[model samples]
Structures are given as structure tokens and as C-alpha cells.
Target: MKHLTILVPDAQTSLNTFACIIGAYDIFTRANQHWVGQGKDPVFTVCLAGVSENAVIQQDIMSIRPEFRLSQVAGTNLILIPAISLDFERPEGGNIELTGWIREQYNKGAEVASMCSGGLMLASTGLLDGKSCSIHWNAVDKLKNLFPRVLVKTERLITDAEGIYTNGGGYSFLNLVLYLVEKYYNRETAIYCSKIYQIEIDRQNQSAFTIFTGQKAHGDEVIRKAQAFIEDHFREKISVQDLSTRFAVGRRNFDRRFIKATGNTPVEYVQRVKVESAKKSLESTRKTISEVMYEVGYADVKAFREVFRRITGMSPLEYKNKYNKEGADLAAMS
Candidate 1:
């Protein structure tokens, strides 16, 4: 049997982490049971490994038991790190032991997968340096700020490179586990699990659900002003040159500061702001796609559609149909 070690963080406690740990274990164990029901042998031997023997959470209201500690396990075929506490600013304290074990496992040819913010812990191992990862969209900026070498993408729901894998926000870990189910077991088995769990299979991107709130916590005063200007005048044709002139900063320096502070270039930031505004209008108002696009300062049909799809992974109409109540009702009828 292939060994699957699900690594639970010792001190970290959160509902998402709890769900991921139990969710992963349930799916893997159920996959084995499904195999046995089909008169076939089990494929995986799953273990819950952690730094401590037990972890208490929710003010000691709940506790988790682990099957093995770091020192007890020699090696394993795979490591699944669940989401941890959202305290992204948690200083590098005693967790060197956990991150070090993760790196050592990867070096020994074990594949590692992190769920949601679990990517933060995996990133501590320096294994994510020069690698692409997907984390919760809300935490993308923070993760990028903390680990500059890691390429964090909010568009994708899952990312897999080398021996490392990651997923986007919340309970999307279910989709990632389903992906592994297809990889290790078979497409049919994964479909079976999908049916049983009521999870939509083959979801590749989280962009459709994104709500863009530009990063404003950076200390760059000029860039913050530029961002505010962009938000205020998104309905107008506000160019970068216009912003530079209005802010009395050099064009090149302004661009550098904007990107550094917001993780998006001036033009990209403007487009995102406009799209975000358009999203709100589409959701709450009965504006047609053209009206929404025009209100957001885009006159060209093709240009608006391209930018919307690039950032959101869907056309304006698709987004509207998904989010707007009337559109959803129409879709349900047809």
C-alpha cells in the first residue's frame, strides 16, 4: 500500500484546518472501502502525523489525535498538509522542526500537497521558492509579501509542480483531494467519490468567485493616493501618465511604487478596480452587460470581454448569470 501521511500542525487551530484534516482522511479511507466493496485491494495506507500527539482547539472544546510524530516516521510516499491558523504574521518560532521535516520528506522523493493556507507552512520550508502556488485569494498579498520568492496565483484553485501541490481558498481542499483520487486511484473511482460527497469534480480555477479588494495596507503614500485616484476615476479614462502628472511623481518611479505596494501594475490595477465595480453592479442591478461595461469606462465590446475573462476566468455574461438573482432564476428555468 502507498503510504499517505496527513501532517497536522501542532499549535495551529482553525475550522478550515479541522475540516481539511477530517475531509482528507475520510476521502482516502472511503476510497479504500470502495475498493474493497468492488472486490479489490486497498490502494493507500493513510496516517495522521503531527509534531505533537494531540492538538486542542476552540478553547479546548475539541482535540485531535495523531497517529505518529515527526521522529516516528522514517519516510512516506506522500505528505498532505492541511490549512493552518490565519495568523500569517506568526513569527518563525519553534515550527522549524515541522517545516524541516517537510523539506526532508520532499528530498526523499515524497510528494507534498498543501491545502489553502497550508501553503504558508510549506512555504516556510523554502521548497516553494521558485515554485508556483495557490492560496486563499484574501491571503495572496500577505503570502507574497512574506515569501517574495514564491509565485502565488489567485486565479487557479489548484497548482502542482515538481513534488509540491497547493489549492485556493476554504473548503476547496475537497476538489484537490478529488484530484488526487483521480491521480492515484482512477477516473471512475474519483467520479464515484464525487457522487458520494456531492462535490463538483474537475473545477480548475477559483477566479469566478474572486472579489477584488486592492491591497492598501502598504506604507507607500504616493501609491496609496494613486490607488485612491484610480478607484475614484475608474469610470473615466484615467491614464498612468495622468496619474503620474496629478501625483507629481516621475512615471517610472510611480509605476515601480504602484506595483510594489499593490502587487498589480497601474493599468492592471485600474482594470481590476473597474471590473470589481462592474461586478457589484451586475450582482445587485439589472444592467445589461453592455451597460455595465460602459459604466465601468470600457466602450469596446471585445476589449471589455477579454479583460473580464483574463481576470475572472469568465465572460461578463457568465459572471452575471452566476451571480445575479434574476439571471440565476432564468438559468434555472431553462
Candidate 2:
């Protein structure tokens, strides 16, 4: 219920990810309207400044400049770095002026937080010298080598720290913001905010005890194409040869890349996705199991039922009963 300004790197910058975060949180707050300037309850005022950087590590990007910069930021309860490209060479050397401004605000009692590479900018400010922070797993080694004084904690997300907070990566970025809203507002507010925006917030921490479950391997463009194709054709039986030809990659290379990047082979991943789609259908639709199965890539009822049982540990009918039925046994678990 307090107005806040998110100072983004100036315009002409490559990507305004943080500004998007500001806009997203504002929308998530259910503040009655898109936050305009200087309103009574301005949940977020995006200050788009110059100094563009890489949006993601998927490509080799050249940093750009912005048309405006933060003249002065004060009286805000929080400062957030959505993402910053802090590299191995002189990681703490770049972004001097911006980091200094953040430090000045934090000294004035504002809580500083960053998501993904944004922690690099915060680390450059020395705010995380003795503090613990979570960073994108890919940059774990570089970050540690760059800043030995900082205590790096790798997990789903990190917060409730004394002076700062950090999240693991882009997906966890939403979790970080939701956690902030929940801390200042309430759990209901956070949930309502997510629901109103139709954002599938991170309900469970992905970086849990399952070792190698989330250990991110190197990025691969071939796998990206396969994923795109899978998302597009979940209703049909997608073939490995078809994907290989469509993406202009060999079947072996495509399979290797997909498995390396997503931690699941193409076939296995598709099977899981098909089952998930069927689960939603069972919950939200009045269709028969055979129809739902065909709708989600499986044509045989028995095969779909078997996959569902193996993955969810429940048959189709049992899952539907537990989910759609009122006060079904193990309803709490459902």
C-alpha cells in the first residue's frame, strides 16, 4: 500500500527486465489499476534508465546505453535488481555509479534485493560482502572467484536476510517477488496477486534435495527448438526424426542436447508433459479418459493410464476422484 519507484537502467538499454519486474509486481499487487505516476497508492513506478545489457546468456549481446538515469532515489522501502551481466573479468569493477546509488539507498534503510545476475551488481556495492546470497547456478563459480568475501548459497531462493536478498535465477525471480509481497503484505495477498495476474508462481522449490535434478548444464539452441516444437504439438505424437529434420539437427545430437539441457530425454519429457496435460483435462474437463488421452498425445486408454499411474502413482479414475470429488480420501494430499 505504499508507492515505490523502481530505478531501471536508462532507456536504449538492451532489455528492461527489472522494469518488467516492477510492472509485474504492480499488477500482482491488485492495486486497482496499472500504476500511474505519483498516485496515492503507486505500488510501482518504473524508472527506465539508459545502460542496456544482455537480456539472457542465450546469446552474445552487446551492451547499450540509456537515455535517462536515476537522478536520485530515496524513501523507497525496497530496491530490486532484476538482472545484471556481471562477468568473470573485473566483475566488481563495472556498474560503479549504479551500485553506489543502491548502497546509498540501502544505508538509508531500504532493503536491497536482486534476482539472478542482479546479485552481481549488489555484490559490487559491497552490501553482500559478509552477507549470504543466492545466484543463478551457472554463475556460481564465477561469482565466488570474483567476490571471495561474499557467502554464496545455492538453492530455490534466499531471503529474510539482515540487509539483502537474492534469488537463484529467472524462474525463482517470481518467487523472490512473491516472497517480498508476502512478507510485507500477507500470504493471501501474494496468492491473490499471483492468481489475478494468471502467473504460474513457483509453488515448489525446484532446487531441492534431488541432486542433479536441477543442476543446469550448458545452454543448447537445438534443445530450445525441440522444446518449442514440443510446446506447439503436445496434442499429437511428436517423432524424434520429425524434430531432428525440423530443427536441422541430427537425431542423435538433438537427443543429446535435449537431455543435457532439460535433464530428460526427448521421449521421456514428452511423456511427462502428455500426462500433465491429461491431469489438467481430468480436473477441468468432462471428457472421457480415452478422449483426454488422445487429446494429450496418447491414443490408447490403457497406455495413458499406465503412464499416469507410473508418474503420479495413481490411476486416471483415482486421480480424478481425489481431485474433482469433494472430501475424497487423501483430499488433503490432493
Candidate 3:
């Protein structure tokens, strides 16, 4: 039997944390039972482990008693960390002790998987350094700022580097668990579990759900002014050279500063601003795709569609259909 450890973090309560722990336990147990029904022994020995005996989630909210404490855990085949909290308050003594144990367990040949914001915890162990990880889009900027060594991929739903696995945001951790089931058990069992749980199988992208907001938290005055200019004039064809000249900075220096301050090149920032504005227009107005394209300074249909898809993971029409209120009302009438 493969030993699986589901870690219950000792921190403030989160719905994802509770749901992930129970969901993982329930699914794995059911999967093992499926094998038992097939005239075979159970395949997994799952344990809920934590640093404390009973983790107090919140005041009078809920408390969970882990099956095993960190000290009681001998050797685990796989370790799963659920999403803890978006605003993590590093415990009184810090999570150094917990992270140390995680590192030691990995060094002893156990694989690790982090779900959603749990990637933040897993990255704390330093295992995700020099590795690509998929974190929730909401936390991507914070993760990048906090852990510069970790490569945060916003578009990917799942990232598997060696034995370390990280998944995208929200309750989509179910998909990650299904993916692990396929790896540990078999394709047939994974499919069966997926059907039983009503989870869509083989989902690979979370880009469709991401909201693109240009990062503007840097202290660069000139770059901030440039960002404001782009936002205000996104409907026009604003050139990078013009921005550099207006700011009295060289083109190359301007590009470098823009990238450093905003994590996007001047051209990319302008395109994002335009696309974001176009998104608003698509959702609120009944403007035709061509009209919206023209409003965003894109005269060519092909160029507009390509850039819209590249940034929003959907074509102009698809985005409109998905988010437009008028489209929804019309569909309801139909």
C-alpha cells in the first residue's frame, strides 16, 4: 500500500483547506475500495497529519484532529498540502520547523503535491526553487514577489516537475487529485473516480478564468506616469518611442525600467491596458466585434483576435458571449 499523508496546516480556517482535506481523504478511500471490489487489496494507506494534535481553525468555527502528528509520521510515499490561507500569518515561531520536516521527507524519497495557495507553503520548503509552479492567479503576483526563485505559471492548471506537483487556484484541486489518482493507480480507476465525483477529466488550462490587471505597485514615478498615460489613452496607437521621448528617457532604458517596475514590457503593458478596456466594452455594450476592435485601436480583425486570445485565452466573440449581459438576456429569451 502506498502511504499518503494529507497535511492539515495549523492556521486560520479556509473553506478550501477543509474541503480539500475531506475531499482528498474521501476520494482516495473510495478509490482503494474500487480495487477491493475488483478482488484486490486496498492500494493506499492515507493519513491526515499535522504539527498539532488538534488544529483550531478559527474561534468556535471548527477544529480537526489529525491522524498523525509530524513526529509520528515515519515514512510517507506522498505528501499533499492543501490551500491554507490567502493572507497567511506565519505562525508565532514561523513555519521553519514544519518546512524542515517537509524537506527531510522529500529527501527521503517521498513526492510532494501542493494545492492552490498551498503552493505558498510548499515553496517555503525551498523545493520549488528553480522550478515552475502553478498558483492561483490572484496570488501569482504575491508569490512572485515573495519567492523570486519560484517560476509562477499563470496559464497552466497543473505543473509536475520531477516528483513535485503544484496546481492552480480554487477548488480545482479536485482535478489535481484525479490527476494523481491516474498516476498512482491506473487510467481506468482515475476515469471511474472522475465519473463518480462528476469532475471533468484532463483539464489543462486555467487561463480562461484569469483576470488580467496590469501591475502598478512599483515606486518608479516615471513608469507610474507612463502606466497612467496608457490607461487614459488606450484607445489610440501609442508608440514606445513616444512614451520614452515624452518621459525624456532613452528607448532601451525606458523599456528596461517599464519591465522592472510593471513586470511587462512597454508594448505588453499598453496591449494589456487596451485589452482590459475592450473587455469592459464587450461586457457592457452591444458593440460589434469590429467596433470594439476599432475602439481599442486595432483596425485589423486578425491582429485584434490574436492579441485578445493571447491575453485573455479567448477570442473577442467568445469573451463577449461568456461575459456579456445582453448576450445572456438574449439567450434566456431564446
Q: For every candidate structure, what is the RMSD over all alpha carbons to the true structure, in angstroms?
A: 1.7, 11.6, 2.3
lDDT of 3: 0.86
TM-scores, each model vs. reference: 0.95, 0.51, 0.91
Q: What is the lDDT of residue 176 in candidate 3?
A: 94
CA lDDT, every prediction?
Answer: 0.88, 0.62, 0.86
Residue by residue across 1-334, what tens digits does model 2's lDDT show?
4434344543212243543355444654453342322244545543434223432112244332332344544356777776755442443322455677788878888887787777776787888988887887666656776687888775446655785778776556777777767665557666776786666565433332112222233467667767767877878778888888988889898888777577568887777777777777777666767788878877777788787876665788877775655324445666
The CA lDDT at 223 in model 1 is: 88
Worst 10 residues of 1 by lDDT: 54-63
lDDT of 3 by residue, 210-317 (tens): 777777767899999999899889888899999999999999999999998887899988888888888889999989899999998999999889988988888999
Q: Candidate 3, residue 113: CA error in Å?
A: 0.8
Off by over 4 Å in 3: 89-94, 324-334
Tell me the number of clashing residue pairs for each predicted model: 0, 9, 0
Superposition error at 210 for model 2 (Å): 9.4
Question: Candidate 1, residue 50: CA error in Å?
Answer: 1.3
Global Cα lDDT for candidate 2: 0.62
